[model samples]
Target: MTLVSQSNEESTCERPTSKYAQYTGVLAATLAAFSIGTYLSWTSSALPLYNKNDTLSVSDQEGSWISSLVPLGAIPITIPAGMLADKFGRKRTIWAITVPLFLCWYIIAFAQSKIWIFLGRFVAGAACGAASVVVPMFTSEIAEQSIRGLLGTIFQLQITAGILFAYATAFTDNLHVIAILCSVAPALLLISFPFVPESPAWLVMQGRKNEANDVLKHFRGAHYRTETELTRLELQASEMREAKASIFDLRKYQKAICITLGLMIFQQLSGVNTLIFYAKKIFDDAGSTLSSSTSSVIVGAVQVVATYCSTILIERAGRKLLLFISVSVMATCMFTLSGYFHFQNSHDLSSVSWIPLLSFAVFIVIFSIGFGPIPWLMVGELFTNNVKSAASAATAICNWTLAFLVTKCFQDMVDLMGISSSFATFGVISLIGTVFVSTVVPETKGRSVEEIQIELYGTQISSIPRETDPEV
Candidate 1:
C-alpha cells in the first residue's frame, strides 16, 4: 500500500511559513534534554564535593556508583518510556519528566546519607532515560521537514548547554546550592511547555485529524496549507496502523535497527561518557596545570560551542561525512592520550602537562560536532512510524547499557591495564567505529521519511511528491 498520496490541487495563494512557533515548541521540549544533561554530568563536579564534605563521606566505590547510576537507572525505564510516548502522547510523556528531575535534585539537596544520594541520582537518571526517548520524537514530529535536522540537533545543543551549566555551577562548594541551581531548567520547562502545541504526527496517529490540523496550522502559521500536510500525515498513519507493528516485528527492519543500535554501541564504546562523567578527575590524574574544575569548565564550554556549530553544518555536511570525521579524529585523540599516560607513568612530564587538556578539548570538540549528536538525531530519522518506538527503546537501552558498562568499568580498566592501556582500548573501538560509519551508515540529510525508507528497503514506499520550501 502507498504511504502518502499526491494532491492534484494547488493553492493559488501561498503565505510565508513562520518558524517561530516551531522553534518555541522545540526549545521547550528540549528543556528535558537539558535537565538530563545536567544529571549526566552532575557526577563530574559533584563527586569531588562529596569526597571533600565531612558530612557525606563518599568513598571511591560509592562515587563510581553515583556516576554510573544514571545510566543504570535508565535501562529499565527505556522500554516503558517508549511505550509511554506511544501510548500517552509525546508532550505528556515529556511533561512527566519534570517530576523525577525535580525529585532527584530535591532528594540530593537534603539527603542525610549515601542511600539518599544514590536514590536521588537514580531518580534523576530515570528522567534522563524517559526524556531520551520522548524529546526527540516530539521535536521531530513538530518540526517542518526542511528544518527537522536543525531542530533535532537542538536537543543535543541544549544537552551541551546543560553540561556547561553543571560544570559552571561547580564553582560553588555547597552541593545543596548546585542541586538547587540544576533544578531551574526543569522548573522553567514546567512553566513554559504548557503553552507549546502537541505533536501533530501523534495527533494524526490517534485519528484526531482536526486537532492535528490545528497543531499544524499553529506550527506552520496562518498562510500554510494544513490540509495537504494533514493528508500526508493521515496516509502515513494509516500505513503504520496496517503494519500493526510491535517489538516482535522489528526483524522486518533489521538494517535500520542494526545501524541505530551499532551507532549507539560505538558511541558509548568511544569513551565519551567516561570523560564527561569524570572530566575533572581525568584532568587531575593527567597532572594538568589547570585545576580540575577549570579544565572541566573549559571542555564543557568547548562542547557547547562545537555542538552549536554542528546545528549549522549538519544539513550541509551530511551525517555520514560528519560521523567519519568525528570518529576518525576521536580515535586519534584517544591514541594521543594513551601515549601521554604511558610516558607519565615512567617520567615527570611537567613540561608537557598540557597534552591531556589539549587532547580532551579537541576530542570533545570533534565529538560534539559528529558522534555526539548524530546517533541521537538518527534515532528519530532511521525508523518507520510503526516500529519507531520499539527501535528507539532498544537503541536507548543499548546506549545506556553500554554507557553503564564503560563508565562503571573505566577506573577498574585503568587499575587492571593502566590508564594508557585503557585509553588504547577505546581508541581501537573508535577506529572500528570509523569503518562502521563509512560502510554501514546511510545519509538521511534533507530527506523525507518516505525517501529514507525507499533508500533503506529498495522500494518506493510512496507516490507523493516531496514538499518543497523555496525559502530553504
Candidate 2:
C-alpha cells in the first residue's frame, strides 16, 4: 500500500511502534554522549589547579591534555569505526565501542604520570569516536522524514546541554570523582541497550532479509514488506553494502566528500568548543570581576539554554534558516568579544574586564543555537547510500582533527598572540564560515537520504547556491 492508502484507511494503525522505540536508542546514545560531552568540555574549566595557577605556569598540562587528547584520538579512530559499524550491526558496534573507555576512565581518574593520562585520553576518545559516527547514522536511518531534523539535531543539542550539566557538576565534584562519574556512563550501553533492536538498515546490508523484516515489524508495529517504499530502503542498503566502500572509495565522491569535510571543519571554526573549553581563561584575561569558575558556569548555562532553543526551532524553521541565523549571531558575538578584548588591551584590565565575560556569554549562546546543531544534521544528510559510510568516516576525521588543533593549540595561541588576537582571529573565521555556509550549504530539512543525495551530488556535479542559505 502507498503512504496515502495506509494513512487514510488505517484507524487502528496505533502510530508506528518505532516512533517510541526510536527514542530508546537515541536516548541511550544521547545519555552516553551527554555524559561524555559534559565531562570532556567542562573538566578543563573545572580542573582544580587551572584557575589556581596561571596557564603560563605549565606545571599541569597533564590534566588539560586529558581533555585535548580526546578530540585528537578521533582522527585515527573515525575511519575504522565507520568500517566496523558497516561490518557489524550498529548494536554490535556500540557493544564493543565503550569497553576500552571503561578501563580508560579508571586510569584517568587515578593516573599521576602524563603518559598514563594520555593513554586514558586516547582510549576514551576512541570510544566516543565510534559512538559519534554510529549513533547519528543510526538515528538518521530510523527517523521519519518529518521529524528527522529534530531527531538528528537532538544529539548535538544534548551535547551542548551535556557541557552545561558537566560544568555544573564541577561545583561539587573533584577530578577523581568526576572521572568516576563519567566512567560509569558507558555501563548503560552494557546493561540497557541490548534489549533495543538493531538498525534494520544494517540487517538489510547483511542479506538477512528475514531478520530485517522482523526488526521492522518490531519497530513499526505492523507487518513488514507491506509497501514497496519500505522494500526500496532495504534494497538500497543491500546495494551499498555490495559497493565495497573504503578510504579510496571516498575519493570517487570527491565533491560530496569535500562538503562533508567542510561541514565538520566549519563546526570547529565556529569557536563553539574553544569558547567552552577556554571560556574561563577568556573571562579571566578580559578582566571579569566574576571569578573564572563563576564566569565559566555562566557560559555553560548560556549554551544549554540556547541549544534547547535550537531543538525547539529546528523542525519548524528548517536547517538552512537556522544555520544562517546562527552563524550571523556567532559572527556578531565574536566581533563583540574582539572589541571587548581589544579595548582591554588598550585600557586597564580592571576597568573593562567585565566586557569579555558579557561578550563570551553572547558568543556561547549564538554558537549553541545554530552552528552547534546544524553541522551534524548537514553531514548526516549530505551523502547518498554509496558514499555515506566513507563520507562519515572522513567527516569524523575532520571533526576530531580540527577539534584537536583547537583544543591543543588554544593555550599556545594565547601565549603567542595574546587573547585579544585569538578572539579577533576566531571572529574573522566565523565571518568567513558564514560566507561558506551561504554558498555551499544545502537545505536538508525534511528531505530523505535518497533525495538529499540527488540534491547534493547530481549527474552534472552541480553545487548548492551560496545565497540559498537562510541569512543570505
Candidate 3:
C-alpha cells in the first residue's frame, strides 16, 4: 500500500491479491480467542475435578469463586487495556496478553494450594479481559466493508473452537496434562501473531500515513488501491483524535452508548455463561443417562458447529435479523429448560429425563447463531476511531462486572430459588434482549464505518442505502 500523493493518482504496479486477503487481520485475533476459550471453559472441567479428592478439594462456594474471579479481575484492566491498545498499538497490546496467559496455566499446572490457583485465575481473567476489548477493535479496523460481518464473526468461531478443545481435554483424567496442553495455544499465538500487519486504521490514527498505506495494500491486495479507504480513515481518525474525547464524554453519544451498554449487559444476562460454566453440573442434575462429561462435551461440540454455521450466514442474513431470530429462539429454549426443571422439582419425571439435554442443545445452537457473536462484533462497529478504545473498554468492563455477578450467584440462585425459577429469570431476560435488538439496533450490514457512524449519530446524510451490493 504505497501512500499516493495527490498528484500521483495512477500507478502501473500490478495489484497483489489472494483469496484470503480480507481475512488476515481477523485470523490473528482468532488465535487469541482460542486461548480465551480455554480459560473461559477451564472452570467447567476443573470444577468437577476440584470436587474430587484426587485433586484440590474445593467446596461449592470456593468453586464458584474460581469461576467468577476471571470477570472480577477483568473489571480493573478494562480501561487500561484500551489505553494500551491506543498507545502501543493493537498488535502489541494483543501480544502482551500472552505473558499473563502463560503464567496462568503454569501456575495452575504447578500450584500446591488453592491460593495459588486463585491467583492464577485472576491473572488469566485480566488477560482475557484485555483480549476481549483489543481483538474486536483490531478485527474491526482491518476488515473491509464488503466482508466485515464474515470476518467479525471469526472471533466467536474461534471462541467456540477453543471451548470445544477444552471439552476434548476432559477425555483425559489428568488436570496437569490439560493445563499444560491448553497453555500451548497462547504460546503458538505469541510466536505467529507478529507476521500479520498492524491495523491500517491504527497506523493512520498515529499519523503514520505511509505505514498505514502499506498495511492497507497488504490486506486489500495489489489490485485494489488504498486511496479512497485511506482518505476516509484518515479523515475519521483526524476528527476523532482532534476532539480529545474522554470516557466521560461518551455521554454525548447517548443512543450509541446505550446500545453498546445494553448489548453487553443482555449478552451475559441471557445466562449463556452460566450454562457454559456449569454444563456438567446442569447435565448431572437433570438425571440424563449420559455421563455429565459426555453431555457437556456434546454441548461444546454443538456450539462450535452452530458458530460455524452462523459465520457463513451472518453476511447474508444481516445482523438485526439473525439477532432477532437468535434471541427469540433462545427465550423459547430457556422457557423449555425452565419447564423441564420445574417438572423435575415438583414431581417425578423419570419418563422425560432427556428434556434438559435436548433443550440445552437447542439453546446453544440458537445462541451461537446470533447473540454469541453479534454483540462483540458491534462493539467494534458502533464507535468512532478516537473513542473506540474508551467506549469498548467501558462496555467490556460492564460485561465482565455483570458476568462476575451472574457466575458468582448462579449456583446460589439455583439452590435457593430452584433451577426452574433461575432459568425462568433468564428466559425473561432473553425476551427483553429480543425486544432491545428489534427496536434499538440498526442494520449495519454492508455499510462502511463512516456510513454507520453517520447513520447512528444522525449528523449527516450518507450515500449508503439500506441495501448495498455484496461486493461493494
Poorest lDDT segment (10 consecutive residues) of candidate 1: 1-10
Give the alpha carbon lDDT tens digit for every residue of 1-472 in model 3. 3566433545533233453755755776777788888888887877787677555798888888998988888889888887899899999989899778877899987889999989999989989888877887788788877677677777878888888888778778678888998988888877778888898989998889999988888887766677888899989887876765678857656777898888878889989998888888888788988887888888899999998897778767899899899888888988998998788867887788878888899999988888877876686677765566667667777889999999999989987998889999999998999889988998888877777767777562233332244745
Among these predictions, the greatest TM-score belongs to 1
The C-alpha lDDT values of all candidates are 0.86, 0.69, 0.82
Model 1: what TM-score? 0.88
Which portions of model 3 show Cα errors greater than 4 Å?
Answer: 1-16, 19-25, 207-233, 318-320, 345-350, 377-386, 435-472
Residue lDDT tens for model 2, 410-441: 76776789766776777788777778778887
Q: C-alpha displacement of 84 in model 3, angstroms?
A: 1.0
In model 1, the Cα lDDT at residue 173 comes to: 74
Q: Candidate 1's error at 158, in angstroms?
A: 0.5
Candidate 2 at residue 25, lDDT?
66
RMSD of 1: 7.0
Candidate 3: give its CA RMSD in angstroms. 6.6
Q: Which stretches of candidate 2 lie over 4 Å from their true place?
A: 1-18, 50-64, 144-146, 222-230, 242-258, 315-321, 345-354, 380-382, 439-472
